[model samples]
Target: MGPGNRPLDLEWLEDFLALAESGNFSRAAQARNIAQPAFSRHIRALEEWVGVDLFDRSAHPAALTAAGRRFQPLLEETLAQLESARIKARAAHDQAAASLLFAATHVLSLTFFPQWLGGLESQLRLGPIQTISDSFHACEDLALQRRVQFVLCHGHPEVPGRLDEAEFPMLRLSDDVLLPVSAPLAGGGGAMHSLDAAEAAVPVLAYSEPSGLGRIMRARMRQVFGEGSSVPTLPQGVDIVFTAHHAALLKAMALEGRGVAWLPRSLIAAELKSGALVAAASAEWNVPVEIRLYRQRADMAPAAEALWTLVQERPPGSGGR
Candidate 1:
């Protein structure tokens, strides 16, 4: 069958628009952050799919042919209509689903969510759960987009979450501490590194920007070490040797004796009990945080509302371990 008979790709249409706007293949490709060859292929594929010559190849800056000019308005309108339909469909699907969607940071998704969900199951029979485990930044994005019913992450009232308090209601679920820790020395003598030590630099395994714990750590460090403290920055007494998005990965690195890491105490409880990890700094340096759940201002699925209500009814210091 000819290209005209096949399904059209919206991406190609977008490419066509980009190429038309830029007036040069190389410029459009650069703007789109795609290789020039790939951009040319997209344009060619678009033309082939439409079975129309959209651009004048001989023109110095790639002027559009008659067919191209005529197709532009129709393509624009079609794309807009398609986008509107997609948004409406997604909203309807979200409204119709009985289950709750949660976006949780990786560490909490592993350590806290299962236990919390188990506890809630006895109180309320949740229909089905859809949880996305990701970095705090990604979870925030999901919550902001209203793609998920809830966002669960470590929140420090001192350092606000990405979602504005006015737009998203928050419930403090539990209290957790960010503990500065490192692997015990050989033969389990002592911690491999200490923040208190007057060493040249304390090698550290740090978290990437996307991590909630990383944000908390950076905020706390700034408060403790003054404004000079920032992630991977050369603070007066510390040096960040490595950076990662996952707290579990940083904990693993700390266990390997690579460097000190500030890990959630809940996550490394087993390791701490086994004498594999030790506090790298005093209690004074530890950052206190809350395990919080955030929801949009708008109403959610009934199951999600019930879950939220159940959580709110819990007395202070009841749910957290």
Candidate 2:
């Protein structure tokens, strides 16, 4: 006999099970779409391998031997399991192709994801996908409702715990950089050098609601500027002042110098590199945030798996500004 612990050859096991069910070599051969002689040879091989007589050839209409009778249930169970496995494999290959939904905060979504996704889309060969852009809270609601496969957003209290419930990990998807920026000064003089020393009236534009970056900025402001000195609403002192969607827009306003804008480094890399924009602060304590991705814990479908792999394959060190 073959090594007792060796895994069964499924194809041979299946042929044996079919032959047992049909009870005739010719009929079993027809069911399997093979020649009768070939079927007989296969069964003989199986019997020799198992070291047992499976059929009583001398009997009319072919009957199972005592050993065959004892093996019947196990053989039938194995066939049934094989059938179930085939169905599941087919589903994963076809019917279970993943439909995808992704949401991101405005800044990261607007600034870098287009390029990242352009790279990702080239790899996906299957399934429908939808990407939503909205406030961080909206992403949360969609993720909670199972409307989206993943959410991309900045820091939030719900974080990894929220993803854990769905059996997904919160991956640090990108490194983002934040900077204070302003348009070229009128006399070609550089803009504000210090948040305090600069004209206090220079309106700092910020989000109207408590948002992911909004909360971070609000807390940091209080800690740094003393209590009750937060910059008031959008365009507070002038109509041209700062504010808008993610940091991309925030950085855009900074380019015009309506007021100082805090924005991601990736958002302004082009301008910064070309000398069109300037970094706001050099202090490491001045900026901290990251872009993140979330996925479900259940068996990931092909499309989701494809996207997940593409997202992970990005070169590391892309900042969460």
Candidate 3:
């Protein structure tokens, strides 16, 4: 016994099963790519470890002893389970190695992230990406808490928020504009109910207070229309009738002719093209916004750093739709 036999190696167990299946020491050794003497030694080691003879050598094609027959199934199952564990462990390790996590606002996650990521994949060696799609506030929290490597959201130059671009480095990724749009009038032909309609009738579909686009729009509205005449208050004096956090939900309501909504051009481009939605306000009311990515100043995982570098190299609007 090697070193007075602390324990038998897993190879000895495998050798024992191979011999049981092949029914010949020489054949088992050949199948295992080892010499007969080594194979016999492995079998002897396993038998010694188990404290019993495992095979009847007197048989022409060696047959299993009663103990070996019982041990055969047990060893086969143990090896299978260990192999499975090995695969899962390697998979987990690879995921940890390549993972780059991101947090994004709901609208961008749906409309922009996929296309933007696809373009990067065409040029870079991106591994795995995990994106958490949430409300703007939630996404900001994830970034500030260091739970995610990057935060992707819509940004306006003048608007201020929790994540100061000064503290967290930012990369402008693309350009988009906010359009105040409404559903086409019931009879159609590309006409829409006006945002400047009767005070009582001008139902306003609005983003909730915590929305990122809403934050931008609020600031821009005050600058464009003056404090008293912003989006919440029409020139004729009507407040928002419906409010929600998601742009998609607001779009749905607007499509049903419920009210006017300030939506992203990227989000409602199809509707605008098809005459399903029309501008609710004039050019002065439109807000120019940038698609921005922000990352902590601290160094992140190598995969995340590589992704950040790739994004920084691309010109704004490089692969945008």
Candidate 4:
């Protein structure tokens, strides 16, 4: 077959390059660790494929013919390009293997993920990470669809979410409290709103339906008050003046004295500490919850698996890193 139609072997190209470099068939064969006859046949086959005599056999040391000379630079460049392509392919594969993907509820992503990841970094060498922060429902969809390796969010055992129903493996990373909080009263005396207020309806900054926290809060409120009670089931009636999918947003409104919001202790710790916010209700009104991480049951990339292993190894109540 002519060069255009021939099935060219890559080894032949390598052998040809070796021979051109050494200019001696015997030495090139030795360098290639191939039998001399086999090496000569490879060169002959390559030359035939190219439709030209690539080497002047009569030279003191075999020399490239005019066509071989032209072929040499092109072959060298082609080989270099192939090697580059090979390296880049391997690098891309390694990066993908080492990378970790996560979906987190917006509040935890902002308030918890950074410190937790930093703690893990102290123990393991992690690769690239991409975290998608969205509403709880969105994060659950990502996890259920296997679009992310892990999902981080709040959970209450009594109020199991879709991930729980799906039987996705989970780790309770830490304990958190969902408690009523509000901006400090004028002159920083006390909370601006109270769960025990006897007179007026308490203005509440509430979570939207899409929020995982909203689900847990609603269920827990029903259990605490009574199944017969309606929404905003606190002992004292409430008026939900604002609703949002993120605790951070509710917190911002609370700071402005807008209303009381049941926010995660982790998210409002700074506010509570600095007196920018205060408990709107007593400890009896607090709802206990878990900071949970869930993963698909299917096999994951090595880095993700390793993270799961580390999380499993941590002692119960040890804040997950």
Best by TM-score: 1
Question: Roughly what TM-score does model 4 have, to 2 decimal places?
Answer: 0.68
Residue-wise C-alpha lDDT for candidate 3, range 1-321, written one tens digit per residue = 342555869999888878888898988999999999989988887778888888999997999999999988988899999999999999767657647888999999999999998998898877877889999999998888887889999998788678875478999999999888888877775436565554455667778887999888767776332364444445464457898989999999999988788899999999998888998867766778999999987998887888888888888999755
Instruction: Please provide the root mean square deviation of candidate 2 (C-alpha atoms, Å).
Output: 12.5
TM-score of each: 0.70, 0.55, 0.67, 0.68
Candidate 1 lDDT over residue span 1-321, tens digit each: 249467776778888999889889999999888899999988988888878789998998999999999999999999999999999999877655738899999999999888888888889989878899999999999988888889989889888876855559988888888888988888877799877663568888888889888887777787333475533333346677999999999999998999889898889999999999999877877778899889878988789999999999986446546
Q: Write the per-residue lDDT of candidate 4 for residues 278-303, one digit (tens) a residue.
A: 99888878888999999989998888
> For candidate 3, what is the TM-score?
0.67
Candidate ranking (lDDT, best to worst): 4, 1, 3, 2
> lDDT (CA) for every model shown?
0.84, 0.65, 0.83, 0.87
Model 3 misplacement above 4 A:
1-98, 189-191, 197-201, 223-233
- Give candidate 2 regions above 4 Å deviation: 1-98, 121-127, 156-168, 192-196, 199-202, 224-245, 282-285, 309-321
Which residue pairs collide in model 1, if any?
none
Clashing pairs in 3: none
Model 1: CA > 4 A from native: 1-95, 223-236
Report the Cα lDDT for candidate 3: 0.83
Better of 1 and 4 by lDDT: 4
